[model samples]
Target: MRTVESRNWYEKSFGEDYLLVYKHRNQHEADRFVQRVIEWLELPSGSRILDLCCGAGRHALGLANAGYRVTGVDLSSVLLQKAKEADSSGCVRWVEADMRALPQDGTLTNSFDAVVNLFTSFGYFETDREQLDVLKQIWMALKPGGRFVLDVLNAGYVQDHLVPFSQRKENGVVISESRVIQNGFVIKEIKVEEGGSRPRFYTERVKLYSPQDMENMLKETGFLLDVMSGSYDGEAYDERRSPRMIMLGHRNL
Candidate 1:
């Protein structure tokens, strides 16, 4: 069940301040990740791609630059505007919508060759059923032979390498973060402060799901589990030490 307080945390957390807090994330790194995805998936040059929860639209833009048809979707209007401004040529299609319900009822159904949910976009909801519903939506949004890439944190590694507190200075702002794993969810409370402006706090929560848990969800969603990679370099998944759990699933042809 979702709590009233937690219900809208995401809406509050992803705002103008978010751009400042995460300013270090750049297009170069995103382009590298996009290149890896292209080689790993062996996707055609003009394949259609849906970048779900695409904050700032870097990866989506990279795919579009590579001659792929891309649609980037995110709930934050603030980030969407940044994405639109970055697209000077206006190549990629940007849509502001929640991941749970990607807009356009029948228009987007079976409309994509591949869907990429990157950087721990999964596990925002408080319930398992709600999270599974997202997978169902992705499954329905793909063509019969389409592929799906779910990039998420490795729960085992997170638990093993849990950092309690951290601090960093970026762009004249001091950022402090306190992290804790409670009730099977990894929660981070971030505080950003400038010299004069008041400190702004944002909370991010991602539920920890095991590899078996992800497998079960994909199987239930009707996606044929294909590969599970631990790193963007295409190494095999090692639950205990891997930094990421990137699963590749296929829709039955």
Candidate 2:
């Protein structure tokens, strides 16, 4: 149900070597995704938000700009550094830590009004239990009646449109891709060939979950289902056409 082993490719690949790739391309896309999450959560100003696995502070920084006290936690020092560089307001409090074993700083125990696990972040753990534990921890991190928002990929759609391999070049960067295999995991291998340099390759393998699987996990973690949307514009979830599986869950008071 979750990823295992020390297979976090982003920690090494997303640093100095590939920061430009992430900053220029992925960051902007992530910003657009965050905007959707913010709109869906609809929390009032001055809310405290915890962004679990806050890669490059996309949503975290955006939330801060929108007037939320944001604490972003991630395992990648390189990404966090980029996040810090892009973080001009100093409004984001970045912490380098694991999502499962959040630091016992006494600062995050039931401290946030909302927690966001965006960009298909829930399935990168080592095992099903570990993945569930991450959800449980998130449940524990929220105040009574707080909300959790997730932007997940539609596994079904991915399988339907499975592309064995592909490539594209942008901003002097050549990106290769591959995907196939399901239920157990979705292996997306992206190879970035930077112009005037050797090609660097990174693979991301994340466990895949169906809507039922996600619903069951959220219920097991004590979160009440709120709404499920297919896209960022508050569109209804359509299995055939939607580009993403965007859903929001709430922790009952």
Candidate 3:
């Protein structure tokens, strides 16, 4: 008998140390990236947008600052609180929830004009059914003709350029990351060492989905493909060279 693999790594992985681990993420860059996305997708001013898996509300706040109504949803309470604290003006609504099952209340279901799942937010589940359920949730959350931006790592690029191990020191901690591609998943083991504290380890595993794989999934989830880009600058997608596979699409009317 086949059973579902437990997929709680994400629930445990995102914590205070994650902020230090992803410290390189820049706000100016997020602003510019979302600006380009707005222009590329032609999202109207004040349109409702759902930032799925919007960790710390970077791009979500970016979109809100650009005059859009934004809802930032993430699973991490630590990150969500950070996002809320940063949003002193209450410009963005922060929701702590898993992507696989979004709020079904009138507040979210079929209420968004667009949805953005940035930073490889997809491909976390252990099975295809669970992954597809996330897409269905995203689809259900959008209004007809709502745009979606799914930014994910390019599988081919990662396979071709997999760095097996790396270590770095930042903010009084030693962070070591080990990467491997196994069982159609990109697995990352992160270890953090701090002063006088035992080393803490966290693991992140994302399914490796190629461009074609995304296309099929999106179509299956009732999304109509619009544009596929390699970068935030709107470069064309190339399987071998693109660092990111950014899929831009829309839910059918």
TM-score on alpha carbons, each prediction: 0.95, 0.88, 0.96
Look at candidate 1 and give me any clashing residue pairs.
none
Q: What is the model-wide C-alpha lDDT for candidate 2?
A: 0.80
TM-score winner between 1 and 2, please give it: 1
Runs in model 3 deviating more than 4 A are: 1-7
For residues 45-141, write the lDDT of model 1, one tens digit per residue: 8989889999988899999999999989999998999999999999998988878877766756899999999978999999999899889889878
lDDT tens readout by residue for model 3, 1-253? 3234365889878889888999988788899899888987687798999999999899999999999999999999999998998899999989999899887678999999999999889999999899999999999999988889999999999999999999999987999999999999999999899999888888999999978888998999999998989988889999999999998999988
Q: CA shift at 122, candidate 1, in angstroms?
A: 0.6
In model 2, the runs with Cα more than 4 Å from the true position are: 1-10, 17-32, 195-198
Better of 2 and 3 by TM-score: 3
Each candidate's root-mean-square deviation in Å?
2.8, 3.8, 3.4
What is the lDDT for 94 in model 1? 91
Q: Rate the local accuracy (lDDT) of all candidates.
A: 0.89, 0.80, 0.91
Clashes of each: 0, 3, 0
Report the lDDT tens digits of candidate 2 across residue range 60-142: 88888878999999888888988898898688999998788888778888999999988667787558898888888798889
